[model samples]
Target: MKGWRAQPGRLAAIALLVALALFAIIKTDDVMRANALVAEEEAAMDGAAILASSLSSELDKFSLLPLALAEDPQVKALVAGDRDAARALDRRLETLASQSDAAAIYVMDAQGLTLAASNHALPTSFVNSNYAFRSYFREAMDKGSSTQFALGTVSRKPGLYIAARVGPSNAPSGVVAVKVEFDRTEENWRRATRGVYVTDREGVVLLTSEEAWRFHLTGSAPAAPRDPAEDLRQFGIAELPRLELPLAGASGEIVQVPLVEAQQAIGPAGWDIHLIVDPGPRVAAALATGRLVLVSIAVVVFAVIFALFAANRRRRAHEEAVVAQRTRTLREQLSQANRLATLGQISAGVNHEIGQPVSAIRVFAESGSKLVAAGETGQAAQNFSEIVSLADRIGAITSELRRFGRRQPGEKRIVAIGEIIDGALLLLRDRIHSHGRDIDLPEEDLRRVTVEAEHVRLEQVLVNLLQNALDATDFGGRIAIEIALLPDAVHLHVVDEGHGIPAASRDTLFHPFATSKDDGLGLGLVIAREIMRDLSGDLVFDANRQHTTFTMIIPRHR
Candidate 1:
């Protein structure tokens, strides 16, 4: 204990070791949390894909069912109200329903009176009922074909209705309709460890694995014109609070079933099929991985501490005769070292700040050299002009570094998103042309879409996005840029035919120090996000589909 007190250096080293241990623990915990989130997002996307495929198959089986049934002779006769032929038509409809696995099949007259039905065997059958108020029957008679979802008046169960007109288009006799309940799909969801549902355009759950949630409206889905309590006898659903729906841009959306999950479009009824799974398993796996990482880091930290302690002990023996003068010198040297460290950090930041412009200069110079070799003197001269401009930019950056010190980069103006895109592509032109990569640019008229943003920061963000895309893509890969002039914002999308952003890294996508590359500082995206936010904008990623998509939204200036 006396020897330990004598060595202040060892104590300082031990403190550092403790700090490092705490840092490792905190970092690991953060990483595990991120990994768990990524796992959930991936699970949601996978579930949506599976649901979409299932729905596609299900729809393919019977998208044309009502059309074919509407053409049937017996169906036409049933719609014509032939009482004697109604029994034969009912038998024929029952066979079709059984064969197609449909919930029900019915023929309704022009006045919406049911003549025959597949479920005529059941007590609450539609054999001789009227459905004049149903939207499906009314829409089919008026538009030749229609699809809708509603609770059955007779069966009192929710189902989708696909209806097609019978007889001539000029003078249709009636409608042939099929009811689909997705019972098999719901049963499958219930058995599996996942939540699944289908919602109509009005955001009402027509079918769901959770029976209680069935026929309920999500906040986004449509609602009945009249309250359910007013017509309690019409449909058997109990009124419930609407669930929140968080939309995920154009391709998909997320539902908070107490957890985030994705939903995709399915069938002609404009139903969004959502799927989600238990997050427990993946979260546990991430925790286990983090524990292993922490253990490994702890071992290394302890080993480093041990080595430093042992060396300090050995040196203490060698300097047993040394005096307080060494301590004084040591303090002075430490102060100098701190100064140098500060300078080193500043130097690294300066390099990072200037790196993009330097790279662009090089790219332009090389392109110009090639043009000169090919006798394109006029173009080569234009490239030289860009070089001079970039040199002036470097000088300005250096001046700023010398005068104002380190600061964020952004100077907002009414800048065209197209100009930003053009600048970025101009920097990457040589690479794009050399690789013969296809680049889809927005229209020239699209340049009219103005966004108030810093020209440098916007170009920097775009360049970084494009460069990352180039790194991910192979030769001959395609890259597309699309611009949307939204009512409030100008949205820019940079799409790439690459493997996509990994699900594991999705949680920290825009966060600092999140990169797959060894040399990456992982600050490009982080800086880009800051720049956009500084200019009253946002940067988001959309990797829901096969490829990668980065969306940059900026406030539009008319």
Candidate 2:
């Protein structure tokens, strides 16, 4: 009756509907991701259990070897004042240690004293003191064969101790101990695990792989340069007692049981084998794929629903067009509102982005003007040249921003991509230093890529990428830009040793008004993408390597 009155309130209703739909879609996505993460953690825990079981089993074999040698009649006769037999036994032990992963092997007296060791060059005066109270010695006394772990005296390293008893009759007479370094233990465990670390009951790390060490040492104070001995002293075993670590997190209390609980005698007390499995990459990949599928379905459904709603709400084709126009206007108003809300932040970013080059130009102009007014011809010439240089820099900045923001079609010209990338680095040099970052350009060999694109716009894209990289990487971590020339296209890649963009956020990383950062307007990557597209190029995320890389590719003959 009211001539089908247009209600502006209906626009609010439509926005509310879109919001609810997006909330549902996002909620479902989060649930799926959570479930996937849980599953991955469970799998990793199960794998660790299997690895522990396998390591215990392998230790049994090593334990048996010492027992066999101790019980051998020839070995007993040799140790019983038979010099020739002792020499032969020492040779055998030496050969075993040299051939296998063992570091040292030796026979001890019935008193748990060191006797003939594996090598003749080894000091026999090194009596195995403080060992009678050792669990391995007790196990050899009772169980005939046992394995334990202790810090090495000579090497100042941690080693696994496998010991067994040798006797003339059935009664045990002496003990034999085989010392295997912790590296060997790690190597064995690495067969089924990513990283393995052996620590004392106090959580003091004993042995770990080089890769694992890198992560641990990252936050430590920088160590002074040293020789091998000093290096070992810093990282190796010490006489200082291990400090206890209190368990505070969800993992609960730390347990210091024997390697075997009841009677298996796998190893000694105060020793733990910790396995670290990096499930990040696998989980990220799986979650990304699943998210893609679910988002695709949701997007398709939402589009169909929106079309149906439009048709139902507006009967005529012209009416539908008017409704679409209204929607566009509403979107624009919303965007303007948001921008207004962030006026301060926008102002700050604009200043940060433009302040330096403008200051440089001002300085140059003032210097030149003062010199010319004084009629100092020589100084004026120098000042003028400087002013020209500064003006050129200001022009470059403007050109870059223009090309980034505008939708002008590209003019293709054969150019070296590396030169453009270096130019970008030059622009950001001050910023990089201010932020405590080091940006390393790729070697000439890696950067020589011939491509066709709008030169100034391409340089703008490169500057954007390198600056982004510097922000992402830590002070000591590397940021590398590489250029590769392919048969059909040229690729420019920016790699950073930083926490990568989350898999969940990758899709919207280049989208306008989409960002995880609190201070960002979300226009940088969007502008970068548009420029690349105008140049008939593409920007994409590449996760093939350990470092995260953003790759831009433009056709060679465009």
Candidate 3:
């Protein structure tokens, strides 16, 4: 009789626990589903806002075209009744339309007769076509400028027409208009979302990623009945059918459908863009995650209670061993990463150092072959000697790069400034001669100045600066090397008269992998700067000048 009474108490406790567990699960599901829907809706809103911004940007980009074209001399002349200007204006508009990615560009008289168009050569050209009844034409003439989105009368394609009046505002001569299409924008939206559409103030869809939704009403019906003629002119249809999209409801409530919708205004044009997304996948994932977390907590609590009575010493020792092994593996990975990074730096240095000599050797070999064919034996022999010298220089560069990679100090010696400049110029002789660029060396007395540096490294730095100057200077331009003697250092400036370095590039001028040249490896300046620092000197850019200047400051050898 006592055991039966205890069973009833145990059963009551079990029922209480079961009720709490069920309540927790239900609450978790509700919270997860609500959060998932909110996230999906927010994401949809972001997408809609981006698409709206893009549409606004596209419209704004082409809006100024008509206004600028209205000021063109040819357009003005054509508007002044000069028939000869029509052919020229046609070609001009064609070129402008192609360059600006516009669907069409045309000029119309005050009476709305198309005088000239970009597609004049096409069979379906707008020339001689009348668009007097178009709202854009009438509004532009009266208000000085106007924009309207409508279906093309001839092509039947939809586009936004931007029009601007030509001549005085009081009495305009004609109007210039540019049409911009949104096929690309709609294609992009289709690739990004399930559904997207843009609606006018009247709730009629003007642009949509879904083809079936275009020219349809977003609401159950139009706010008011539209004139059949006006509807036909704007949308090529007398009436529009409502899309099956549902209106957004209050948030956090579970709905029958799994779709979330968001809308954003495109611009002041009273256009609204709607983006739809399916939240079923996110909601399912959240539910699965919540259940897994709840089940894991239950399992972990049971495990912890059981682990308190188990053998802990062995387990703790095993965990320590595992941790030690993991530490060793991570150390090995870090060491390997360090080795790879060092190897990459060395490779870049070798490539930059060897590039100039290899190019010189090729130029010399080509000249030598030509000289041999022309029976110029002495000149050919000289070219062969130069190629051999360049080959030896390449070998030296590889050894220097290895030392640089190892962080070993290069051998320093007293090198005259003149010799360094001469060496660099000799290496770039072919480039200078080919491009017809002038190099103005310092005075002969100043050339005798000496600096404490590694000869080859110093020569390499000069070569890099001179090469950059050569690339920047135009044909027949001048590059000057000026020497400024300081109390303890010598400042050698490589100045070029070509287009100066862009302001945007000055900050990252010496950063690795930052270059203005299309073919540049972006390592030359980095290596050059490092070499200067290694030699106990520094390289710096001088921006307070009319031309681009790079100054190399070195310790003067007494």
Candidate 4:
């Protein structure tokens, strides 16, 4: 009887040990699975955010097109019933649309009649189409500008239409619109993730990687009910099909449906991008890792704890040393990279500075050859002399580039303002004649004023400014150079009859890589400003002027 009682106590102790082991295994698995799920959710959310940003960037690329087109003189004339401008405007719009990779660009009259379109040559062209009922057109006419996503009435394709009102807001003449499609964006999303979709404020899917989910509603009901007629016009469907995504269970238990979802807003648009992720593999791996950890803890509890602790301390120290070495190496690499970047900028500057002289040289050479063939010996000799001067200019440019690379300052001396102006104009004479643009030089006495500066650097700055003016001015446009003598400084103003710089671009006018020209490197003004500052002078823009103006201020030579 005593032996039986003892056996019952032993059995109870064994049962208690088994229960504790089971509890530990279950607890470890739960914790590990939960952590893994959280990590997966976070990663999915980050991915969704990145995708949303990309979509926003894509949309932004074409957002300014309509506004720019709205300001076009040809578009304005066409809107004013100038039928002769339609042919030229159509070709220009077609070229612009092709270059910008936009789906379509079109101009509409006050009646919302498409007057000209980029696809006017095609059979399905938007020309002659009336979009008076379209929200994009109506909204733009009322609000000055608007963006609307809808299905194309004729093409039956979904795209975002960005529209801007032409002329004054109070009496708008017409509207300019650019359509941007998300075909490439959707393709990229399809390759990057599964079950990616974008929903507007009404929970209707506007864009999706899965074609079947497009135009589907997100929840049981729309956020705001839309008019049936508007819904039909926008999406070609009055009743949108609900999206049926497999969602995870609410109990925090790993269920058979292992999908996790994340949502991110795209720009100011009340559109949300959703990314769906499958966490089945991650959860399984976490469970396996937990089981292994439990086994390891049980085996190493008493025997290897102290040894492991000491080894861990040694390993940490070694890792710290390694990290310090890596940091030093990284710092050295970064220094080297900075040096390379500086070298690249210098090279780009040299390349840009040399182009004008080289072009002038070619023009002189060609003229000389033609003159020689025509038996005009004196004129040919003059052309050859100009070529030699251009070659000398090239040599000076190279020398300056080398000195700049070495960080050596150029020697400054008193130079007449007329000398700088004459040198720059001489180099660009052929270009000026070819473009039929005129330059109004300062008065003879005003040109006599002297400034203290490096001759080559000052001439380079002037040349850069003149070249920009030449580019900005239209054929037969006039550019005027005016010199004003201050008590301690001389101001050289370069004014062009071209369109003034937009207010939005004024902040970055002198910043590197900020340019309005399509083929410009955006380094000329930056280099010119730096050169002026180095010479104890300054460069500034006059924003108050009706025309474009750049002023260079130099210390007056005593």
Candidate 5:
């Protein structure tokens, strides 16, 4: 009954019903809009197909005219025996090239010998070359007034060849071939918004509305034309017939006509036409209107729901915010408590550490006062020496405390690793002497290696590892310290003969708060590792033989 107040529950149920109804309506509208767009695109593609068929038919008619002209008596005489055949052929070619979109013309004498070529200036001499192996040759001699698409070897041009034989055919007569440049026809077709090309069985652009390049297999080559297909290939147009996979330059509709499979006219060759389409006006308008309608309905539904549950929604939101605030406050308070507990432990250590230095100073002052009261010169000198020693000890303890408490400096300098070990040992000297632990030093000649580092940080790292080794070893147990100089690095080792670090804990010993000590802050090794890394050195633990060796490696150059 806590959340069952009639106003909030009833309003929530009513809002849910309204939301579901609106969602259904919106989804239905979206589906309808998508289907309509698809239908419009299909209609546009059908129109492109009709245009392609009409254009192909027109090209078919034009292709036949070239063959008909080749059969003329005057053309035959010029091709067969005229000594001025080159000039006549030139005139005929120019006429044909101008009359139609043909690129060039050539004639063959009786017995299938090349007579003359239209483009005399062109470096191709087609004279006396049999046209027997060519597609146009086969069509003219056997098929009669036929056109074929093929790549010409001499000129390296791909075009349509319309060929015809004249006078005494079936025996061996003259032949004329008209070369229609498919590239020009392709260029004209490309001007439309949606356009494509068609080719015969030989991959020649027959009825094309798109730009294409020429590739010939024969004839003295002319200057190569600029390639338009370069950019088109990058835009995925080279995958033609497969062009319908997606629109190239823009989004919307695209269609492809696989002339070979779809129309069955030139099936062997990969002939196809592609159509790029723009959306129709009606479909565009429909999409805009549908979006507006959907938005309006969403607004109305939201308004009605808000009106029904205005007060209750406000109350619930406010309650949730208050609860969240309380939860965050509790978490913060718990975190603060944990921090204070940590501070308490560190404070106790600080007090114990400082007490020793303060007591020693007090004892030294008392002894100085006793010597002053006695007024004995030699005894006074001895008391003064004692005071000086205590003072030095106090100073040393204070420095170590300050160093441990303070932040590290950013400046770096060349520091000898042995110097760091000496500083740490000085601070531990009193404790080491009191415990009667044996300390060893490297031989004078072996301790010459130096490395680039922060001196204070290197000392701190050494002290941390040394203290851990001391705490682990029993009284009178051996703890060996060694410094080995290698070619690249100087290795500092602290090995303890007491119970070695457990195999499981060895890997994570350098991690924060990882310790075996009962009252351990668990931060010493962690801090050591961090400082070593800052100086481009590393601290690692190794349990090679029986001893647990903590090795600090500092690179000589770094």
Candidate 6:
């Protein structure tokens, strides 16, 4: 179990991978945060630029109103104090104001006394009021033209007042003023759900969607520097501190509660319009982006980890498979070497077995030669026949041994078990006779017991088993080969009348080179078993029995 566990190096590699993943997670979070910050800043800058452009375009449309009004003949006549033309001029002013979306249009003498106005029908009309105190009127008298954002004296509406002189500079007569209210502009901003407002040079919020923010100074100022009005009658400077103006100044948010701001100058009024948008959603979006990046990084990290792990596993398995194949090849090589060694050991026994037959053939031939000389022709023929039979036996034995000792895989076919036994007896007959042992086997049993096996290999198996039995038996001892017919296989048992295999040699009796006799290699049983198994059979030895028996069983032929 301990050996089956993962090696420390492999465990350490996994741990290192986990550490790397943790490190990646840390770096990924940092990278995500940085990227999110960059996106947030860029979005803020873009939002500001878009808002500034929209605000500037809204104010630029009414910039030429004062120049158009000043050149009108009706306005010029009214400015010259033509009392009879007052009724027509008033009608013209009211019509012009209504048509042009102006809050009010008025004519003021050089002394700032209002002559006529679009709102003259109202109780708070500009007809009698002296607007000499108003900056737009005074600035036009001196500079001929000016843009001013102020509270209207007649309508009390906050508007941008663009005014121009009516007469020549040498004899200036009056100022014609067009007051454009930004109520629609403010409404547009409100509808768009944005915070927008315009501030004059003095930093006072003249126009805003929030009515309560009017007249409030958006920034610190030392008393409304370069005040537009000579007399601040309509606008109470004392109440400026109490007005609540929503502002984030030039930078930062410009909403009612701003985080960033975009400021642009309104061309006609010379005022700074501040545009603010909520930053809550942008901050939320940045956070969302950071989370998404982290999640994506985590997924990639885990995927890489999984792939690495799988690849490592496959590599290890391939290495193990290669190692196993190498071991199997080594085992086969060793087995083949052992077989060749066994063949060398048995060759001497084969020479002795063949010598006996040759000696017998010579003896029978000499007998036949003597009988032929004595003129017993029939008897001589029988003697010669016996010599030929012995010679054939010798040739058969030598041929089978020569073919079996060669390094070749023998072909398998259906063969009778008796044929294998007869071949083995042929080779071992001299040894059997030399040992003075009788091998018992009935001719009827030999042909009926059949097996499927290679002819030479089967003969080799029987020879090895019978040789062992012949060697173990005492002089004049009996050796028996008994065939046991089974349902699936044919079993041949070679039993020897000898002292049983020693207890100490029993375990490794069939082991190669482990032998009881000094000259024995102990590979006989090993080779026999190997041969039997190659024929889809097995070798079993029963040393515990009264008589030692070595059985070679091969599968029955169909």
* Ten-residue region with minimum lDDT total, candidate 1: 248-257
In candidate 4, stretches whose alpha carbon ends up further than 4 angstroms from where it belongs are 1-18, 220-224, 245-258, 298-558
Q: How accurate is candidate 1 locally (lDDT)?
A: 0.75
TM-score of each: 0.48, 0.41, 0.52, 0.50, 0.39, 0.45
By lDDT, rank the candidates, best first: 4, 3, 1, 6, 2, 5
Writing each residue's lDDT as its tens digit, candidate 3 over 31-96 gives 999998888888888888888898888888998899998898888888889888898889988998
Evaluation by lDDT, superior candidate among 1 and 2: 1
Q: Per-candidate RMSD vs. true structure? A: 24.1, 21.9, 22.0, 27.1, 17.3, 32.3
Lowest-sum lDDT 10-residue window in model 6: 249-258
- Shift in Å, residue 398, candidate 1: 99
TM-score of model 2 vs. true structure = 0.41
**lDDT scores in order:** 0.75, 0.62, 0.82, 0.83, 0.62, 0.72
Better of 1 and 4 by TM-score: 4
Write one digit per residue (lDDT tens) for candidate 2, span 407-443: 4435667877776775565456556666677776767
The best candidate in terms of TM-score = 3
User: Ten consecutive residues with minimal summed lDDT in candidate 5?
Assistant: 213-222
lDDT tens per residue, model 5, 237-292? 33222222223333223333211112223322234444445444544566667767
Clash pairs of candidate 1?
Answer: 202-221, 202-222, 203-221, 203-222
Q: What is the lDDT of residue 352 in candidate 6?
A: 87
**Which residue ranges in model 2 land beyond 4 Å of their true spot?**
1-10, 122-135, 168-172, 185-274, 277-287, 298-558
Superior candidate under TM-score, 1 versus 6: 1
Instruction: Give the best candidate by lDDT.
Output: 4
Question: Which of candidates 3 and 6 reaches a greater TM-score?
Answer: 3
User: Which stretches in model 5 have alpha-carbon errors above 4 Å?
Assistant: 1-22, 123-130, 188-287, 296-558
